[model samples]
Target: MSDLKKEAESLHKAATALRKVSHHTIKPLHEFKAESDDLGALGKLGSLLGATEDIREGMHTLAKLTKQLDEEWQAEAKLMGDVSDAFDLLDILLAAAAQAKKG
Candidate 1:
C-alpha cells in the first residue's frame, strides 16, 4: 500500500480502538458519580467527608469539557468531511456522560 493508505489505515484502527474503549473509559466516571451521589445523600454526614462536593463538581466540569470537546471535534470532522462511525460512537459516549452528570 502507499504510505498515505498505510497511515490512513493506522489512524482508522486507532480511532476504532479508541471508540471501542470509550465506554470502558467513561464507565468508571459514571460509577464514581453514582457512588458520590449516594454519599452526598447522607446530608450533614456527607459533608464531613470534606471535598465530596468538590469531587462531584470536578466530575461535572469533566462532563462539560467532554461535551465541548465532542462538539468541537464533530464540527471539525464535518468541515473536513471526515466523520466516521468511530467518532460518532465517541459523541454518543460523551453525550451519555453529560446526561449522567445531570441525572
Candidate 2:
C-alpha cells in the first residue's frame, strides 16, 4: 500500500476506536442524568441531580466543540497528531466528570 493509504487507514482506525471510547464515556452520564431526574422530582437528591444536569450540559458543550475541532482539523490537516491527543484528553475529562457525578 502507498504510504498515504497506510496513514489514512491508521487514522481511520484510530478515529473509530476513539469514537467507541467517547460513546462509552458519555453514555453513562446521560443515563445518570435520566435517573437523577426521576429521583430529583421527589425533592430528594435535588442538589446531586442538579449537579449531574450541569455536568451533562458541559458534556454536550464539549461534544459540540469536539465536532467543530474535528471539522477544522479535517479542513486543515496541520497538527493532526494533536487533534487526536486533544480528543483523548477531552474523553478523559468527560470520563472523570461522569465518574464524579456517578459517585
Q: Quantify all predictions' global Cα lDDT against the true fold.
A: 0.60, 0.57
How far in Å is the alpha carbon of 92 misplaced in model 1?
32
Single out the weakest 10-residue window by summed lDDT for candidate 2.
73-82
How does model 2 score by TM-score? 0.33
Question: Which predicted model would earn the best TM-score?
Answer: 1
lDDT of 2 at 39: 46
lDDT of 1 by residue, 16-72 (tens): 554455455467766765675555466776578686678777777876677566556
Task: Give the per-residue lDDT digits (tens) of candidate 2, residues 1-103.
Answer: 3344455556656655544554554576556545644544535464755665665566567666765755564444434445655655666676788899999
What's the number of clashes in each of the models?
0, 0
Candidate 1's TM-score reads: 0.46
Clashes of 2: 0
